[model samples]
Target chain A: MKIGIHGLTSCYGCQLSMAVVKRILDVSEKFDIKYFYMLSSAGKIEHVDVAFVEGSVSTDEDEKELRMIRENADVLVAIGSCAIHGGVQSILFSEGIGYEEAFKTVYGDKKMDYNGRIAQPLDKFVKVDYRLPGCPPEEEEIMYYLATFAIGSWPEEKDYPVCAECRRAGNPCILIEKGEPCLGPVTVAGCDARCIKYGIPCIGCRGPVSDVSWFDSLAMSFRDRGMDKEYVKKRMAIFASRYEGLNEMIDKIYGD
Target chain B: MRYLKLGSRNIDEFLGRISNYGDLYAPQKISEKFYDYRKVEDISQVEFNYNRTITPAKKYFIPPKHEMFEFDMETGEYTETMGDVKPFVLFGLHACSIVALRILDGVYLNEYPDKYYAARRKAGIIIGISCLPDEYCFCNLRRTDFVDIGFDLFLHELPDGYLIRVGSERGHEIVDENMDIFEEVSNDDIENFKKFEKKRHEMFKYEGSFDNLRYILELTENSPLWDEESEKCLGCGNCTMTCPTCRCYDVQDLPDIDGKHGKRIRFWDSCQFRSHGLVAGGHNFRETKKDRFINRYVCKNAYFYPLGTSYCVGCGNCTYFCPAGIDFLKNLIKIRDVVGEVAHGEQ
Candidate 1:
């Protein structure tokens, strides 16, 4: 089947992650890598079976490319945290900041390139058939998705918190045991509890799982562990500030 | 049952002998208050004073991730093989976990029969230990603080030595092989055991009859408690997966990139997951947070209890293990303590 790996306003980390999946899974043997902007010079495509879009729409050019790719593909997958939950670039978006002030604040008077706009996830503009959420979508998840999609099925997402996988990994609860403020209970799994395994606490890069009510509970629990309430809010806002539920929790606790 | 005494000084050698069989697993101190079952090279690292490990001994038998068999797509060939199952001693199991093992055996060894889990059980020898309860433990509430028939051997820790009980033939075999490390239990050892039991009971905090909980669970279908808890419920499955009695799972194929070679694997699954209850037409029965949150309590009490087995071991793994620290017993206590008239089927 013809597959296109597209990138927009990103660090190209997702594409790099897909390259790792490509080498590990030997994806080129099964798939026709027709229009990966990073891989091939030949860009134009009439139609494709699946289009994996990375990054977020942060420009008029990005918006048009995403729409065109959506029109030319049967399946459009949001392939990373950027395309799924608006990545680190969406920090300003969370604070409701605009490009003019954002650019001026970050890089004063350096006016050059393209029409830059506030970043947003792909589903905000067009339908995303699936979302593989992570800082760079987990390598195994991308492999699992492609392997299942090859057989005309889709893999079920691991929607539980990272604490579940951490238990499976047989790691001690860093938060409860050592009194560290970890986000494993509030964040999504499928990262194999990566941060927790290495003795570092989870920063919740993949965002909170759906149907989570205990984001506030976890935040307060961290507060109970002697962390400031604002510190807990700021940590959550680092990765999951865009999620309405997390924001509601932040609002409930801080009344902002 | 036979009673013997082992000096605390000879523990490492006795355990080291058990390791000669194959592998010996003991609870290792992973963090300040946490312990986990780890393969032991030195018996000195084994500890029994911990309240709860991240997982119970059930994890050793059923496992969190298990490869059932391997398959090759080239010729439609499948190979089912019994994995390595050398005999090993699981030393320092808490009294409550011995019961948890029986609970797991009743399910996996029943009609359907999981051969993998059965193999693990056959190869594993249980050595129960004395556990002093803390504020979080409620195992006594569920009558899991002691066992009579399940373990091969049990060690009651005393000041200078351990009072040992031989429950099965395996326990006798161990004693016979290591006669140099054991001695006949004296009158003084019996007195020590009785005193230890008294102090163990005193460590428990929540002392109330659990007889009325089943009724409270059965009648409270529409309680607002479900809605109230859902407000803070992440439905993270930390409660159910850590639960010793909760044994839900899912099996799936893990094929290679070429789809030519693969293995079928089984892993731990939870009902709190969005797709766990999803059905035909993409309809999820437990769509709401309340539905998933309440179903867990129902499964523990209303569902698993009526089957004539202990469903909640009350080891307090879920209480302290959870990031939110949402205790199921607190919810159950709330449901049981309501003073008004019964409100049936409101949920």
Candidate 2:
């Protein structure tokens, strides 16, 4: 099997995490890593078994590249939280700032003429067979899905809340022990409560679970803890502004 | 079920007993209201009842600064390094925190199968203990409690001694190795355990349910709340840094003095920061604080949900740790109420 990895406008953590897997194990033996921008020279698109795409589609170049990859690859997997749910880049779409204004602000005084467009996850433009969601895709998870895909068996999707795993891991409940607000309950299960296990609370980097209502419960969980309603709405809006349902709920509950 | 009668003073004896197995890591008081897990020679220094540590135990499985590979610029060659540490025992894990580890395992072990995380994970054994609820605690609200995933053994403190619950085959091995120190549980002891659980539950309550969070989040979009809430955010990133589940990170290639040999390092990044979404040619996606601020919650509550699981755990850490004192709970209510008003044309 051959796999190609690409990055859009992301932090490159997903690519780094994949590299970490190679160090830990000889994944190269299983699949031929045909192309990676950071590791190898950009190679011509070939008929590959799987193409792992990272980051969000923020530019015309990214959109064009994503479309080309989708056309060639048999399976397209959106790796990293950004690629799956726009990571942090989707924040632009929520604000009224068009892509053009955003570009001018960043590249001030540069004679770069370009049109503005809202950033979106790869799925918005092309079909994604699978999604490995995380700010930086967990190295182990990437391998598991790949191996599973390689074996011709689709990996079962996880639906448990982060709190479920947190409980099963036998770590102290951050909410009960420290009165700290966490996103474990509504957030998806994957990150192994690493933050909570390390004495920090969950910040929802993995994204929400299957149920959208879980986010409402998370916000309510905060309110029950005596947190200010407006504060919760603002904090949640930062990562999921494109989720119109969640946005409307936040506004209603917070009286915005 | 088994019972052990180790005195608090003889905790060092317990550590000594376990040392024969492998390395021992326990919570040590770093400062007032702060504790860190470190290699310990003496068990007396282990603080079993800290509210919560500044860092989550996830560091052991996934170190904050791990070297995935080393590159030599002179040769343009890369050498991958695997972290092969000895098997170590982590002592004094809280229930919520352990749940956090399980969440990570689900992500790392399932679809992608992270070799680095899996390799490091195999080198450690977890020992958990019950935690005392504090003012900021809300684990009950999230439906979290003492659990036994990936842990060999769990310790529940009693007035007279400690009750040990064997959770795995490894736990049974540990117990059998130290058979002299443990005894079988009796009917009376089981009754006492139930009483203890009851007392603990009385002190803890489910703060709220996430059932309505999605609806609230959906309505809040384009609501005035985004502007109102963004006004107070300083974008300092304290919330993300202190978050247990916030795994967003930035990878940078660090060059050596000669710029020939350098290592790539991953550091925690936050959505709250303005530059978090910036790309090459200087295109910033999330330019406004309002957009950035709203995206954080959406990622946790809405966007991540359809993909798989809800990223947020409702631990209340963001509320306690926010420097600007942005309360997540209040925001939920405000968003819900406002979205309702707007929908009803009452605005």
Candidate 3:
């Protein structure tokens, strides 16, 4: 019943998306919105039923807050692409670019009192009970999960690939018909493939489906379509960049 | 078990009978060798045996730009608009596309009920037709069969008339209401149906075996050819847009010029885009094209399998539409071969 929402160095889309849900329906009667940095005044923390945390942990301030929240909350849910994975911020790790260089790029020689390392998802700091993966969580999905959690019956997590949904939606085979490089075959299904439905390939934003290794044929199926090896590696790395096994695969293909 | 012996003259009568329920959507020729599904007034206008359409049957259930909800910014109020639902008929759905639809149903309807999608889906009836296979089609390879998922109705062409199988209660209703137009199917006619099904199987052969897919991914991980293969990629994102399975999207608030009023919208996005995985502070996880490209493969082939569905359907649309002519099948073979060679110390 008591839910706390917080964000650290994120686009705030996930929190905003939850707000959109509140406006759409009278969910207040069902949920007690206790602590939210954006929606309400920052107040003394208390024990909560569930804590919805968004964004990657990019600052020491965030790490302290995240640790405290994890220790107190019964359930911790990573609410978007950023929190579920290191998100785009993890790209810095790939290039060995530190936060100092990033700050310099923006401030142009301005003296910074403090700078930290590149950011990572909250899971790197503490255990995450659940994940609603997307650039911004889908409203329908958010509502479903909330309702399920409220009833004490957790919604079964979908481990299927996006391709299953894409096919079910009756969209044309984009990879075959349009020769587009798509991540659907590998990406997880949650958004009902709104992107592929609207004439686009999946970018693997929802992270890997479940057992990424089982769908190897689907990946090779891309190659059978004449996609370059480098092109496939780069696309797969978008969401699974933090996944050591996936990165190792990329290293083997591209030679470090 | 009802058969319709429609002489060329009774085609109009057939169209008229179906339209009484609601709108009838069927394939229409847009240009030479291109067809699109649209509402048809006359049955003759429907192209029943066309290869495939530019878009799949998903448009009916999930439109290109659908409003999930409308928000009034000043009032800070939101209204949920339930998608329109009406009983209508979808004519001439192919086997490959229908299988795609079933896969989507498993995701949206089974696990988490998508009310908006379910509403629109309930409004339509699927009537499938087996058409000539296309060169790019590999539905059989994926083990998706024609007429497998129970459609409301299925049509098979014959020399004299058509054989109609009523697969659902709604389909039987249409037949029962129009008993005057149909004749009971004979035992010989059933045998003919089996023949046609067999012929279809013979026509569409699996080009390659899928058994080695997992091993292929393992071998490809360290293959050096990926570097050389990705050089020509333009990152235009066309392949993903046209794919049946690619579902990644970007959500943004589209505020008006005044920056006061805006609607939150979700649009189709591609990993191929440079900023797809970029964060607010300007860190891109998959910075290089090589990494992004490889990520796509791992997700589809490796990651998606664990999730309970294979994202790629082996449609071959990506190969056909690539402007730079990236051949997915050939590249897969090359990776397999190269990876095998390296393992054997022969490369």
The candidate maximizing DockQ is: 1
- DockQ scores for all predicted structures: 0.59, 0.02, 0.03
The residue-by-residue lDDT of candidate 2 on A162-211, one tens digit each, is 66455434455566455577766556666767887787877777866543
RMSD of each: 2.9, 14.9, 12.5
DockQ ranking of the models? 1, 3, 2
- Cα error of candidate 3 at position B271, Å: 27
> Can you rank all candidates by TM-score, best first?
1, 3, 2
Q: What is the TM-score of chain A alone in each candidate?
A: 0.92, 0.89, 0.88
What total of clashing residue pairs does each candidate reach? 4, 161, 75
What is candidate 1's CA lDDT for residue A140? Answer: 75
Instruction: Give a tens-digit lDDT track for model 1, residues A1-256.
Output: 7888999999998888888764544798778777877776787765988899999888999999999999999988888777887777777755768889998988899876788887778888999998777888887788877777676667676667888788888887788777787888778788888888888998888866755536776766776678876678777767666666776776675566
lDDT of 3 by residue, A1-256 (tens): 8878888778898888888774334456667777776776764467889888999888888788889989889999888877877777776665556788887787877874544558788888899988887788787677766765665545445544576556444456566566677777666677777887777887878876533332233345566677776677667666766654665554543455
Q: Which 10 residues in a row give candidate 2 chain B its minimum summed lDDT? A: B302-311
Error of 3 at A127 (Å): 1.3
- Per-chain TM-score of chain A in candidate 1 equals 0.92
| Model 1 pairs whose backbones collide | A213-B233, B221-B347, B222-B346, B222-B347
Query: In model 1, where do residues sit more than 4 Å from their true spots?
Result: A22-25, A210-214, B302-309, B340-347
- Give the DockQ-based CAPRI class for model 1: medium
lDDT of 3 by residue, B158-187 (tens): 544567777788888887887777776667
